[model samples]
Target: MRKTTFLLPIIVIVVAGLMSALFIVDEREKALVLQFGRVVAVKEDPGLAFKIPLIQEVVRYDDRILSRDVEPLEVTPLDDRRLVVDAFARFRIADVTQFRQAVGVGGVATAENRLDSILRAETREVLGSVTSKDILSSDRAALMLRIRNSAIFEARGLGLEIIDVRLKATDLPKQNLEATFERMRAEREREATDERARGHEAAQRVRALADRTVVELVSEAQREAEIIRGEADALRNNIFAEAFGKDPEFFEFYRSLTSYQRALKGSNSSMVMNPDSEFFNYLRSPSGGRAVTPPAPLPQAQVDAAEGAALEAAEADAAAGTAASEAQEEAETDVNNYEVDQVEDAEDGVQN
Candidate 1:
């Protein structure tokens, strides 16, 4: 019983010791065997792994693709433009032995820190040679490719294989953003001003064209009107000439009548002129300017009545003159007879 107890305890201890010495390596992990802080072996395959009990330690790392996010960093490009960049990377531990050697007991933390530093350095080197515009442009993919290559090259020392190096954001620094926005705003304003100026120029051109067209139209219309007026005046002149040629006297009479109408147009019109003036030729003779013989005598009955009235008026005048002479002779005789009678009376008296 004592032996069995001692053996059982010893076996239990042995099994425990063996269990402690042996380790499991997962396919998803990369393990390194370290003795006295030195990496002695690496296990990358999934299986049972062995280590010296109490003398060696096993450190495991995730072999799967890992991600590291770099903090936002300020970078000045060759153009002296500053930008804030946030980036991340995908990587894997490609060599556990090298990882163990490079980053002793710090394990994944140390490896990741060193890898992050290399990635950040590569990012700065590649990105600093270009302008911020290129970093933010479609060409960013090519720039990232360069950064990844550089990171991969440098990451070999840290046992890291870079899958990708990508920028999350490449933006103007906060202090520069306002200035950029202002510049952009000013540029837009200038563009708008230019557009308005162009519009005004175009409008002026249109107005000028319209005014020119209007002038041309008016000139053409005036020309047409003048043509029509001239044609009408020619026709009128021709008609006047034909009528005058046919009967000059009649034409003169008609012209005089039209002149009279115009001269006596209004109620307030008054004209003083010699009655025998040539202007009265039409009135003096119906043949206008031509002289004519006297008109034929009136009917015999009308002539006899006029002569009879004249004889009666002459006889009445003669009777009035004869009566006046008789009165005068009678008055003289009375006076002379009175004187003779008085003288005879005087002589008689003297003789007595």
Candidate 2:
């Protein structure tokens, strides 16, 4: 009965000891055995792991990818502008032995802290080298690549592989954002005002040129009109001279009748000339001869008719004057020829 009792306690203690030495390494974890606070063995594969129950302990580490979102860091740019940035990093323990030696059982937290410091330092270095505009534009990719390279260099001694380092958000500090927006607004307004001034100046130049063109066109039209009017007046005077030169006596008699019609139409005075006057000669005889007497008075309507008939008679008398002038010229020509013949006869008699 004492042997049974001792064996039963021994078996129970042996089972409890084995249970304490044996540990489960899940598919997502790796185990490291530390003997007397020194790393003696590392189990990278997932399965059961064994260790000395009282003298050794097993430290498990995650073998999967780990994500760590860092706290937002405030950094000053090269231009002295303050910005807050949030970032995240993905990493994994590529060398479990080295990780265990370096950080022990702290798993990803130690690597994450070291990585956060490196990321913050390198991010500020790269972002400080450029302006805020470059960070917000196409250069952001290049900036990220530089940051990744810097972080890789920094994390080389930590026995952790930095898979990726990404920036979550980059923003100006609240205190400075309003001032930046105001400056941008002022720049845009200045550009707009300059554009409007250029447009107004261009329009003014165009209007001035158009007004000058209108004046030139009007002056050109007036010059052409004057030239045409002067030509017309010259043509009219030439026609009048040509028609009057054909029969000067008849033209002068018709002009005299026109003058008498104009003068007698509005006259209130009576003439007191002698009956033998040359003016009365045409009224009495109606031909080129001495005047005899004035014609008898007639009714008013007949007087007007008689005046028209007298004008007609005056035109006939002018035609007779032309005939008389031609006859007088012929007589003068005969007298001259007779005088020349008499001179020739005297010369012939002297020769005889």
Candidate 3:
């Protein structure tokens, strides 16, 4: 029983020693074996690993891709415009031995610190070489590649492989933001003013054209009306002339009646004229009594011849004077009676 106890203690000590010499590495990570603060071996594969018991130690590092965000940086572009740039980077540890040697016991924290500095420097350098317009354009991928390439070259010494560099945002500084907006507003206002001026000019041109067209139309209409009125007046004058030529006495009588109708249209009509005026001629005598030119008188020689013939005939007819006077009187009476009948018939026809 005493021997069994003693053997048990020895076996436990051996197990402890074996355990101290062995380690396991996951596929997701890499490890380094350090002796007295010196790197002696690197474990790149997964599964089991070895180390000197109580003499060497193992340090682990992730083998996958990692990301780091760089603090916002201000850069002056080639155009003298300043901007704030926010960025980040993706990277992985390419060499564990070189990493351990560079960072020593600082681990990932120290490596990330140095990497941030590298990215910031490269970002400023690359961004400062271009104008602000290009930085904000769709072709920014090329600029990001430039920064990543530069960072890769600089991070090689720290055992870091830079995968990519990306810009989250590029904006004006807070102090310049309001100023830029004001400038943009002013430019837009100027453009609007120019557009309004052009519109006004075009409207004025159309208005002038319309006004001129109205005047021309009115003038043409007036001319047409005047021409029609002139033609109607000419036709009326021709009708009046034909009526006058056919019968002057009837024309005058009709004209007088028309004048009386127009002058005495209302019950309150009045007139002041002589009772025997020529205007009353048609009213007093229905048969026209207009003056006419008389036939020329006989010549002086014919007057003496007519007087001698009348004397001879008077002496010869002395005996028959009484009978002749009675016969002539009866003939005159018949002629006068015929004239009276003609006048009465004319009056009856006019009345009808």
For each candidate in the order shown, give its overall lDDT on alpha carbons. 0.75, 0.70, 0.78
Better of 1 and 2 by lDDT: 1
lDDT of 3 at 42: 90
| Per-residue lDDT value at 191 in model 3 | 61
lDDT, candidate 2, 42-65, per-residue tens: 887778889899999887778888
Model 2 C-alpha RMSD vs. true structure (Å) is: 28.3
Query: Best lDDT goes to which candidate?
Result: 3
Question: Better model by TM-score, 1 or 2?
Answer: 1
Off by over 4 Å in 2: 1-20, 35-38, 53-56, 95-107, 129-137, 140-146, 153-157, 232-352
Give the poorly placed runs of model 3, Cα more than 4 Å off: 244-352
Models 1 onward score TM values of 0.66, 0.57, 0.70
**Candidate 3 clashes between residue pairs 3 or more apart in a chain or in different chains:** none
**Model 2: what TM-score?**
0.57
| Tens digits of per-residue lDDT for model 3, 1-352 | 9999999999999999999999999999999999998989999899999999999999999999999999999999999999999999999999998888899889889999999999999999999999999999988999999999999977989999999999999999999999998898777666656555555565555555555554555455445444544554454455556546566656667788888778776874878899788777767775546653332443555455445444544544452444445545555555455545555554444344
lDDT by residue (4-80, candidate 1, tens digit) is: 97899899999999999999999799888888888888888899989989999988889899999988888888899
Model 1 regions lying over 4 Å from their true place: 1-8, 133-137, 140-142, 152-154, 245-250, 265-352
